[model samples]
Target: MAEPSNSGGSIVSGVAGRYASALFELAQETGAIDAVAADLSTFEALLAESEDLRRLVGSPVFSAEEQMSAITAILAAAKIGGVAANFIKLVASKRRLFLLPAMIRGYRALVAQAKGIVSARVSVAEAPSEALLAEIRTAIAQAAGAEIDLEVKVDPALIGGLVVRVGSRMIDASLRTKLNSIRLAMKEVR
Candidate 1:
């Protein structure tokens, strides 16, 4: 896969982006882009499912050795090998594990761009059903006129409805925002 250009505000340009770009380049050269992405997704899921792993990844109190040992064991148990595993282990050893989430995001953005897919973030009040998800995907895909990689986040604070963000454009249709708008309009009338 070709390297996505690192333009201004690009996902492949910061500290995390640098790591992600390096990993992406390596993956491309080795023809392991998909495998690395899968492994990274598995690790991200594990991070989301466990507070201990989150703490391990985010806390700076842990020594590099401690972090490396714990992460290595976790990766081994999770069967995440190859470039993904090595890249993560390197991050732990360098005491930069806290940036793992951003790195993963950067990597995903790179992969999406390379595959000619648009990345969209959808935030909803609750977890949407599979049918709802499909509908949203369809709607966005139609609007974008391209394949979309949807990342759904359940944010109860939204109360209802959903907010969709594609690249620099964001559509805020959440109940919370709607109510806020109404409140502002009423105040203006008074």
Candidate 2:
């Protein structure tokens, strides 16, 4: 990934950040950051896998009370901790349920920064060896001057090589891009 601009402070500092900061502060006060993070992870996974859940949260037709009840039930079903369960209720009450995913992402970014870690997304045609993963993580950590948490994804369309993304910066070194470049060069040569 391309380097993040130095001017960008604290990876999470927007509307999402405001909500996440509030949640993070509450989690810290209750000594439940870990629990809340886990709950958010569960919610994130749910959102990723379920369009119905995502639409429900984003729906404006649901009254605040209705949303709160629904969310509370969902959390209970998922066995989320008390702190996170209560926080979900708070978001529902405020009609901010739609912001949950963004808030979760923001909170994660905050937590990572607080722990001196940077999150990186690595995409390749296939999974790399453990040693290669370690080397990539080390290189990213060195470049970012922080501990690295790498998230790997496989994209067969990449053909070969890797694409690394860290926040807004992206390093595109995929064979697909190389082939496109070569194709353009050949056309120019003709």
Q: Evaluated with lDDT, which candidate comes out highest? A: 1
* Candidate 1 lDDT tens digits, 1-190: 4457746445577799989999899999999999999999999999999999999999989999999999999999999999999999999988899999999999998998788899899999999999999999999999998899999999999999999999889999999999999999999999
RMSD of 1: 2.7
Report the number of the highest-TM-score candidate. 1
Model 1 lDDT, full chain set: 0.93
lDDT of 2 by residue, 34-118 (tens): 8889988997787788887888899999899888877887888888867777877888898989888888888887677667677
lDDT by candidate, in order shown: 0.93, 0.83
Model 2: pairs clashing at backbone N, Cα or C within 3 Å? 1-171
What TM-score, over all chains together, does every model reach?
A: 0.82, 0.81
Q: Flag regions of model 2 displaced more than 4 Å.
A: 1-10, 127-135, 142-145, 167-169, 187-190
TM-score of model 1 (CA atoms): 0.82
